[model samples]
Target chain A: MARLVEVDDAADPRLADYRDLRDVGLRRSLEAEHGLFLAEGEKVVRRAVEAGYPPRSFLMAPRWLDGLADVLATSDAPCFVVSESLAEEVTGFHVHRGALASLRRLPLPALDEVLREARTVVVLEDLVDHTNVGAVVRNAAALGVDAVLLAPRCADPLYRRAVKVAMGAVFAMPWTRLSDWYDALPSLSARGFTTVALSLAEDSEDLEAAVAGVDRLALVLGGEGHGLSERWTDTADRRARIAMSRGVEVGVDSLNAAAAAAVACYVARARSAGA
Target chain B: MARLVEVDDAADPRLADYRDLRDVGLRRSLEAEHGLFLAEGEKVVRRAVEAGYPPRSFLMAPRWLDGLADVLATSDAPCFVVSESLAEEVTGFHVHRGALASLRRLPLPALDEVLREARTVVVLEDLVDHTNVGAVVRNAAALGVDAVLLAPRCADPLYRRAVKVAMGAVFAMPWTRLSDWYDALPSLSARGFTTVALSLAEDSEDLEAAVAGVDRLALVLGGEGHGLSERWTDTADRRARIAMSRGVEVGVDSLNAAAAAAVACYVARARSAGA
Candidate 1:
């Protein structure tokens, strides 16, 4: 059973893991140095623990305790109970969902291990937005992509905002970061996966046509502003673009990164099923 | 040529259209009462002006003046010059893009006018998030969606955050609010458009299958939290769902409203092409 500690003071050092939750920069370094990540709200907190991320600690109000009793029962971590106002004071935002868990980070599996049983994969490069990162993971998982490969600079899936936006899909999807960003696509090609980079290149084939005959496939997406690095785009087995309707000259230059991922994943899944 | 007015005070009454822009509630009422909307950044400002939303005024630092000279040359609207600091003081947030334009909100086109030549339409109902609203418009435009119809209670597409997220696609896509929320879907059917509600109903066909043979397609999406209201779901011509991979039941319930819109629009676009 989890130990329940009633705390009136917000300055308790035990609550350090929950401090400055709104400070992305501070939280990033704090989380990295401590090898911990946070899951907010009751559902995501439960999912993280259920996914075998051992809890470093939990912070919540008394009202949330009864609802999360089952989640608390499975761990020996201390639950720092605070008033809702105090919780807000410590976290720098209203604890709207009322429950939060700080969980230990696990070492990501090697690329080979993740690829062993995977036939369809989504490869993301240099995507800096956490929400977009989370959205892609959710879309990839929903459309039956077996694994996700992140380029070295891709936003952290374990970030709290990403975790929330993903609705905890990050806990379920098999993914790992590529250490070798320079050779990521070429290496995937060598592993028998067709690395289809999503771009707007002149000779790029339509997404549906590009995925038609692929047996093992990896869909490569780039970061927000400037798309894939030229090196990665050039090395990919094939280049494909989502068909933007002709004559759309205005703000339709490109679909948002997450939107592109959804269309690409859905089309690839449909074509793969027929193949 | 546009009148150049250099104002040093952040509280200048004429700058009211650009004041407290970070406050959504205030901006909504202010924009509505004055028959105005705002576009920010150089590109979006340029596009909004070029799209013929007559400028009420322009707010920017002197540094932005030269680049936007052509746009300013096109309008007789007052140009307020302020330091970047004062711009932040007036807007309640750092105006990172450095240029803001307050544009006149012309009355939206009637439903019949928007639908006259549109073979593919996207209908949004009660989506509360501005970002999601913008994203859907961007996706719909990119995929050749002819028009977007919003239920009466849907978030305003002309809101600043939505405009920024849409990257000015809000100006490009033809859209208007449905006066009757209850009869919106049925009316589309009456106009010979097959209304496909994106839902998770038990008998909901796969999106691809649902859109396969439709001639005039209207893809309906719901709000962020609840999928769709019962009345809208039951009244639709057909219900369809983006297929989620079976056997993975952890966190993948449905796609984000915008992501779903992207996939649905892409599939419907492809199917319409074949049709």
Candidate 2:
């Protein structure tokens, strides 16, 4: 059974893992140094634990305890029961969901291990937004993409916001970072994967035509502002676009990166099914 | 040419339209009563202006004026120049984008008018999140969906955050609120459009199959938390789902509303092309 430690003081060092969550830089460095990530709310906490992430500790109000009793029973981690106000004071935001779990970070699987049996994959390049990263993961999971490969600059999928937004998909999906940003797509191509960069370069084919016949597929999506770099666009096996209606030129000429990934994943799934 | 009026005080009465922007209730009431909406950031403000949302005024740091000079020169609206700190003071948040525009809200198109030439339309049902509504609009616009119809309670697409996330697609797309939420889908059906509600109903056909052979398509999406209400799920001509990977039951069972809409729009667009 989990140890129920009642803590009244917001400044307790035991609550350190739960502090200053809104400070992105602090959380990033702190989480990185501690090899820990947080899952917020009851659903995400439950899902994270279920996905085999061992808990370092849990912080929550008394009311949330009853709802999460079953999950708590399975772990011996300390559960710090703080008052709602104290929880807010410590976390720098209202603990609206009333529960948060600080889970130990597992070593990321090797790129080869993740790609070993995968047929369809998404290779994200420089997607810096944490929410976008999580949303993309959720998209991949829903659409049945075999795995996800992150570029070196991609936002941490294990970041608290990403984890919360993903609803624990960051744990459920098979993914790993590419230490070598330059050769990421090239290596995938060498390994018999068709690396299709999602771009609107002149030579680009329509989305459907691009993924039509590929048995092994890897989609490369770039960051929000400028899109895929010229190098990646040139390096990839093919460059394709989710064809826009002609009138899109009026204001929105492009889909957001996460939305593009979702569309591309669906298209890839459809093509694979038909093939 | 626009008149440039320099202001030092954040409390100036003329700046009221740009005040307390972070307060949803305040923004809604202020915007609605004044028949105005705000567009933030250089790009979004530019797009809003280009889309012909006549500005009530433009508030910005002096640095932004030169970049938007050409756009400003074309209008006679007053441009209020304030320091960045003052901009933040009035907006109740850091105006990191350093530019904001309060524009007169044009009368929304009638429901029939929006649907008149639109073969592909999206009907949003009670989506309370501004960003989701904006994103769906962005997707619909990019994918060639003709228009968007919002349920009575759907968040205002012209709401500031929606405008910013959408990159001003809300201004680009033709959308109107449905006064009669319950009967909205049936009305679309009466007009010969196939109203496909994106739902996980057991009998729901795969999205591609649901849209196959259809000419006029209207996709109904639900809110962020609970999905489409029973009324919409039962009232539509057909219910459909984006097929998920079998393993998705481990965590997420569905896509976010905006992602779902994007996938559905892409599928609908493809079907329309094939037909």
Candidate 3:
């Protein structure tokens, strides 16, 4: 069981990990050095505990503690009970969700291991937006994609906003970050997975036709502004596009990359099921 | 050709339409009363103009006036060119996009008009988030859904954020608010359209199967937080769900309604093409 500690001071040194979250530099540096991520709201905190990413500590209003008693009973960390105003003052914003948990960041799984057992996986290339990253994970979880592989330059999936937007699916899905994207493609192919790049190029096969009869597949998605890199286009087994109807012009000529990722994943899953 | 005027004051009476936009209540009320919406950035503004949404007026920096000379030449409205600082002061933030246009909202086509000529359309139900609404429209445009029918409870498709997020698709796509959703369904059916509601119900058919061989179709999508209402569900000719793979627990049982709408649109288009 976790130890319940009562805190009345807004300036308590023990709450440093939970402070100044909106300051990018301070938060990013702390994440980089200490490898910690925040899970906000009661539901996500409960999910974190269930996922075994047990909280190191929790900060909540005294009135809200009873609601979390079941989750707290299973946690081995310190639970701090504070006044709502004091909690707000300490955290630099009104904690509207009533409770928050700080969890230790876990190292990503090995790419080879994730690929070995997966039939459908997503490879994200340089997707930097945290909201997009979160949404992609949410889609992945919903549509039954087995895992997510992040290429270099992708944002952290455990970022606070990402966690909130994903509704804690980041804790549930298997994900890994790869430093070398080119070297990663052949191994995926070696596992009998087709490395499909999503692009808007004319030479690309229609997405509906390309996804047929694949036993194992990796749908490679790109960043927001830039589509997949030329290197990826050349390396992928096939490049595919969603067919567009007449008089319908996507003003920017493509869907948001995260939106594209979700569509691609759904297509891949459907194709796999058909096979 | 539009006349360009130089303005130095942030508080200029002519700039009333563009002032204090960060205030949600004032902006919403203005949008509701005047049936006007703002489009930001050079790309969106240019698209809006090209799509024939006449600009009521424009607030711009001197740099944009020179760059968008061709587009500016076509509009009859007054174009106020101000310094970047003054533009920022009026907009309540840095005007990095350099130009903004306010457009008078036009009447949407009747439901029968949209359905009569359409092979594929999206019927949105209570999708209240402006960003999600914009995203759905962008996807509908890209994926070739012929029109968007906004239920009464849905967000204003012409709200500033919706227009910007949609990349100006609000101006490009054929959309209208449905005053009576239940009465309108029979009209849609009269036009040879099959109304398929995207739901997660037990008896729902797979999305792939639901869309197969349907020439004229209207996909009903609901808000992200709440799935389709019972009333909407009861009216649907068919209930369909995106297929998920085995052994993957979809921790979050739903996709972002916009994302779901995109996938549904893609599936419907693919099925129609296959038929």
Instruction: Give fnat of each prediction, in order.
Output: 0.75, 0.70, 0.58
The lowest-lDDT stretch of 10 consecutive residues in candidate 1 chain A is A245-254
**Per-residue C-alpha lDDT of model 2 across residues A117-203, encoded as one tens digit per residue:** 999999999999999999999888988888899988899999989888787888878999999988888999999899999998999
Runs in model 2 lying further than 4 Å from the true structure: A272-275, B247-249, B272-275
The order of the candidates by DockQ, greatest first, is 2, 1, 3
Write down the C-alpha DockQ for each prediction: 0.70, 0.71, 0.53
**Largest DockQ belongs to which candidate?**
2
Give each model a TM-score: 0.98, 0.96, 0.93
Can you give the lDDT of residue B127 in candidate 3? 94
What local lDDT does model 1 show for residue A170?
Answer: 93
Q: Candidate 3: lDDT of A138?
A: 90
Which lDDT tens digits does candidate 3 get at residues B1-275?
78888999888998988987788789989776877788899988888888878789998988898777898889899999899999889988888788998888777787777666778889988899898999899888888888899888899878878887788887878898899876555556776788898987778998888888887888989886887888888778889987654324535877777788888888887785534
> Candidate 1 lDDT, tens digit per residue, B143-260?
8899999998899999999999999999988999999998999899999999999998887998888888788989999999798899999999899988788425756767888898
Candidate 1 backbone overlaps, count? 0
- Docking verdict class for candidate 1: medium
Against the hidden true structure, what lDDT does model 2 obtain?
Answer: 0.89
The per-prediction tally of clashing pairs is: 0, 0, 0
What is candidate 3's lDDT per residue for A1-275, written digit by digit as tens? 78889988878898887898777678889877877888899988888878878588998988778888999998789998888888888878899999988888777777777777787899888899889999999988888888899988888888888898888898888888987877667667777888888987668997868889877888888888877888887788888986666434545466766678888888777684535
lDDT of 1 at B23: 89
Interface RMSD (Å) of candidate 3:
2.5
